[model samples]
Target: MKTYNVAILGATGAVGQEMMNVLAERDFPLNKLRLLASKRSVGKTYQYKDQVIACEEATPDSFEGMDIVLGAVENDIAEQLLPHAVKAGAVVIDNSSAYRLDDNVPLVVPEVNPQDIQKNNGIIANPNCSTIIALVAINKLHEYATVNSIIASTYQAVSGAGVPGLNELNTQVTQVMNDEKVEPQVFPYQIAFNLIPQIGGFDEMGYSSEEMKMQNEGRKILHHPELNVTCTCVRVPVMRSHSESLTLFFDKEIDVEKAKELLANADGVKLVDDPNNKQYPMPLDTSDQDLVYVGRIRKDLTQNNNKSLTLWCCGDQVRKGAATNAVQIAIEYIKQNA
Candidate 1:
């Protein structure tokens, strides 16, 4: 078996750490695993299988001799650093939105568009966490019915905002329980037992930056230039998985049972639909895992024809949305080049 040298940029962060775990969990063919982060995170130790690797400061030449570089940093840092990885001859699979829409970079969801991986010009962009989860749940259906448009409302977890978001939610819950005043820091308002309707800065059209990602990123990944999406991204108090309500309009009528059957056999998706049994996808059940749980499949009540359907989905944004998806792309890239 051939092994590759892999480096993880932003290794000390949640998603970066999860990338290490996923590599080990998936037992990727690794000759060496390097953890790279900012200077402040240098020397931080992380467990990967039987080895404890210490973090190193990421420099311009850090990616030299690396076969794969998984990026889990913010957009600014990604913009500044990832190109160097590419320049150093590493196939960079980035989780940030920095290069997603770039003409040369392939935005990929392995199950939805694995073919796109081979088209990358040294960089492959992982779609937004919400976009990844939604697409994984619906891609099979889309292949069958040819989805035309989507109306989606996302209930994103605090973890989507990273460790700080998780800490803020925890601190606020404690304060509220003790009858103390709630102070907001990571979020615009208290996220404890509450929902924030906004996930990112508002656009001129009132859509948030996060909301627009669904429409824009979705179009690119699905390769459906005409696909329309109206999305509302909300920050919920849930600790891990992000859940979404998706109403899909397809070019042709799709039967609910057939949809369920397809999803039951779909890659990266788990069918949890059984309405009478009160069984469906939930964040609690989907957390800490990679599969996107999809359920509550039904015909759209507002649609006169059977061309529309509604469903619910949940997935661990930190994993499938960010870390695991990047690793999956790397896996596909390896296969394509092997």
Candidate 2:
């Protein structure tokens, strides 16, 4: 087996660290591994298997001879550094919203659109984590019947906000438990024992930036520009895994039994729809894994037609939503070009 040189941008952060873990866990073929981060993280060291790899300050020159670079940074840093990495002869699978909707960049969900990898112009953007999880859960249904619109509400985990989100939640819970005043930092308000209906800043249309991604990114990834999505994203107190309640409107009728059969065989999805036994998809059950657990499959009671159905799905936001998806894109990219 031949190995390629791989570098992880933003190695000190949560998703960045998970990228390293995914690469290691999957036993990806790599001749070398490089960790890059901000100047303050330059001297930090991260363990990769039995090796201790030190972090390097990311610069245009840092990606000297790498084959692939997995991005796990913010939009600003990605804009500044990724173009140079591409110019330096490396294909980048970026996790930021930076280039997702760029007509030039390809937004990919491996299970849904692996062929789109071929259209990349040196960069393949991973779809929003919630978008990725939602698409994967219902992709087979889309294939069975033409999906026209989606109405979704996401119960996203604190892990979606990275390390700071976790820290803020933990600190607030501790403070509030002791009857002390809680301070909001990473989140706009107290996230412990409460839910925040907003994830990103509100748009003029009253939708948060995160809420809009479901429509915009989903349309791009599915290659269905006509697909319409109305979404509300909430920040829940869970430490990992995001759960979504989705009502899909299809052009054709799809019963609950058939939907279960389709999803049971779907890649990256696990069917756990036994409501009688109390077996349903939950954050605790879906956390630390790649598969999106989908359950509570049933027809929409209010629709009065077979064209619509409702389901719930859960997936580790950090893994499948971020690191794993990018790595899978890199894998598919390698196979097509190799």
Candidate 3:
């Protein structure tokens, strides 16, 4: 096996830290690992197996002599620095929405489109975590029955917002328990015991930016140019992992039993669909893991045909959605080149 020098652009955030952990967990061949963050986090240290890695202030010069740079930062920071990494001859697998829709950058989910990794020109963009999970849960069904339309309602965890979001939820819950006034900051409103229907700014059509991603990124990744998606994104009080309810319309007929059979053996997906015993995919059980757990299989009564069905899925957005996805892309890149 060969090793590569890798750097994580946003080494201190939730997703960045998960990326580091996933690399170690999956035993990514490593010659060197560099952690990069803002000036405030410059001296912070993190645990990676037996080594204590210190974070450095990210600069254009930081990408020099690196085989790969895994981006786990916001779009603004990624837009500012990733180009420099590419110019310095390092392939970047970004977890941000910075270049997801770019014609040149491939928005990848290894379970859905591993071949897309080879078409990258020094950059590979990981799709939104929700998009990744939703697509992974249904990709096999799409293959067997040709998914034509998607109806999704996402119950996203506070961790989707990062560390501050998690802290806000914790603080609010504690304040509520103490009968104190709760201050809303990390989210638009109190997310302690209530749900926020909006995840991002709403468009003229009343769809949030996060909702539109289910369609836009899904179209790009699945290569289903005509795929239709109607999505509703809600911020729930859960701590980690995201759960989605999906109603799919396929071109070909597919029964509930068939859907379960396909998903049970699908790659990157775990089947937990025994409803008789009250077992189904849930965020509480799916957190801190890579595979998307899918269950609650049933025929969509509203569709009026065998061509439509519904299912539920859950995945750790921080891991499978961001960090782990980028690391998997990097691993594929390494294997493809080798």
Candidate 4:
């Protein structure tokens, strides 16, 4: 078996750490695993399998002799560092939105568009966490019947914002329980016992940056440029998974039973649609795993035709959405080009 040298940028952060876990869990073929982060985090130790690897400060020279570099940093840092990794002869699978829409880079969701991986020009961008969970749940349906449009409402977890978001939610909930004043820092307002309708800065048309990602990234991943999406993203107090209510309009007739049949055999999806018994997808059941749980499948009540269907889905944003997706891209890359 051939093994490759891999490096993880932003190794101390939530997604970065999860990338390591996924790499270990999947038992990726590796000759060496390097953990790279800021100077402040240098010497931080992480366990991969039975080996304890210490974090090293990421520099231009960090990608020396590396075959793959998984990026889990913010856009600015990704913009600054990832290109250098590419220059050093490493193919980068980036989780940041920095290069997602770039014409030269491929935005990939492995199950939805693994073919696009071969088209990458040294970089592949992972779709937004919410975009990933939604698309994974719907890709099979789209393939069976061409999806013309999507109306989605996302209930995002605070963990989507990273470790700070998680910490802020924890602190605020505690403060509220103790009858203390809540101070909002990571979020615009208190996220404990509240829902914030805004996930990113609003556009002139009133759609937020996060809401627009569903349309833009979805189009790129599904290769359906004409696909329309109207999305509303909300930040909820859930600790891990993100849940979404999706109403899909297809080009051809697709009944509820057919949608359920397609999703039952779909990759990366678990069907839990026994609504009569009060079974449906929820954040608590879907958290801490890679599969996207989909349920509540039914016909759209407002739409008269069979072309419209409504369903709900939940997935762990931190795992399948960010870390596992990037790792999957790397795995696919190795399988194709190894």
lDDT comparing candidate 2 with the true structure = 0.94
Candidate 1: list runs displaced more than 4 Å.
none
Worst 10 contiguous positions by lDDT, candidate 3: 297-306
TM-score, structure 2 vs. true: 0.99
Residues 1-338, candidate 4: write the lDDT tens digits: 99999999999998999999899899999999999999999998989999999999999889999999999999999999999999999999999999999988999988999999999989999999999999999999999999889999999999988999999999999999999999899999999999999998999999999999999999999989998999999999999899999999999999988999999999999999998899999999988889999999989999787899999999999999999999999999999896
Give the residue spans of candidate 4 off by over 4 A: none
Clashes of each: 0, 0, 0, 0
Worst 10 residues of 1 by lDDT: 160-169
Measured with C-alpha atoms, the lDDT of residue 46 in candidate 3 is 93
Clashing residue pairs, backbone N/CA/C < 3 A, model 2: none
Rate residue 264 of model 2 by lDDT: 93
lDDT of each: 0.94, 0.94, 0.93, 0.94
Model 3 quality (TM-score): 0.99
Could you tell me how far off, in angstroms, the CA of residue 251 lies in candidate 2 after the best superposition?
Answer: 0.4
